[model samples]
Target: MKYEADSPEAYIDLLPEDRQEPIRRLRKCILSNLPEGFEETMSYGMIGYVVPHSKYPAGYHCNPELPLPFLNIASQKNFIAFYHSGIYADPELKAWFVEAYRERVPTKLDMGKSCIRFKKPEHIPYELLGALCRKISVSDWIQLYEEKISR
Candidate 1:
């Protein structure tokens, strides 16, 4: 779904009733596990956790004026997506996430380089996702992102 919300709360309010609860639960899990210095905002039509410009003036590599993206949660036509920038830039974290997810979730793991796609938010493994979120701080992500993009 194409969303145009000015804030994360607005984004959530835009979702259908069936989607709201699941996304809320997922958002709770994500926020509870998030490390310090990450602020929630609306980005790319989704609920985004980012390193604000105040903390990282360079912002995102593709758009320097925007805040650096950390993670994004969105409801799509066919599925819900959780985009983890940390796992995308760090191979070790990706491997660990995959292995841990495989051990916990009996269903197939549908994912891209950074986005974990699920037909419904309830299908996601909250514990593992939370653990992954806890693994990366804003500073850690800035360093990792800088290293990856600098290459």
Candidate 2:
């Protein structure tokens, strides 16, 4: 997906009408469980929740101007995707996410290192998604990001 909006709200608005409801529901799930200090914004051509520059002045190690990305939700070419940085870093969390997803949804989980792709809104594992979102805080993510770059 191409970068379009400068803000989260704008990003939501730009989504196709059919994609809007699912994305909005997922967005609500994300926002409601998000920890303090994470800021929602448009990043990497998606709706992103990130550790703000104010919270970590060094910003993302890969690009200093960009804030550290924590999670993102995007309507892709064929699927709605959820990107979770914490799950990529923590093997334990990844395993747990996979297990929880299987327990919650009958469909096989479609996932990568950090991205979970769902074909439709009905396929979303909302509870597991919210739990994943709540698993890491802004400070925790900064620490994890720091550790990752150092290694």
TM-score of each: 0.95, 0.94
Give lDDT tens digits, candidate 2, residues 47-134.
9998888988988777889888889999998899999989888888888888888888999988998899998778888888889888
lDDT of 2 at 127: 82
Q: Candidate 2, which segments miss by more than 4 Å at Cα? A: none
The count of backbone overlaps in candidate 1 is: 0
C-alpha lDDT of all candidate models, in order: 0.89, 0.87
User: Global lDDT for candidate 2?
Assistant: 0.87
Model 1 spans with C-alpha error above 4 angstroms: none
With candidate 2 superimposed using the best TM-score fit, by how many Å does residue 98's alpha carbon deviate from the native?
Answer: 0.6
Candidate 1: Cα lDDT at 114: 91
- Relative to the true structure, candidate 1 reaches a TM of 0.95
Highest lDDT scorer = 1
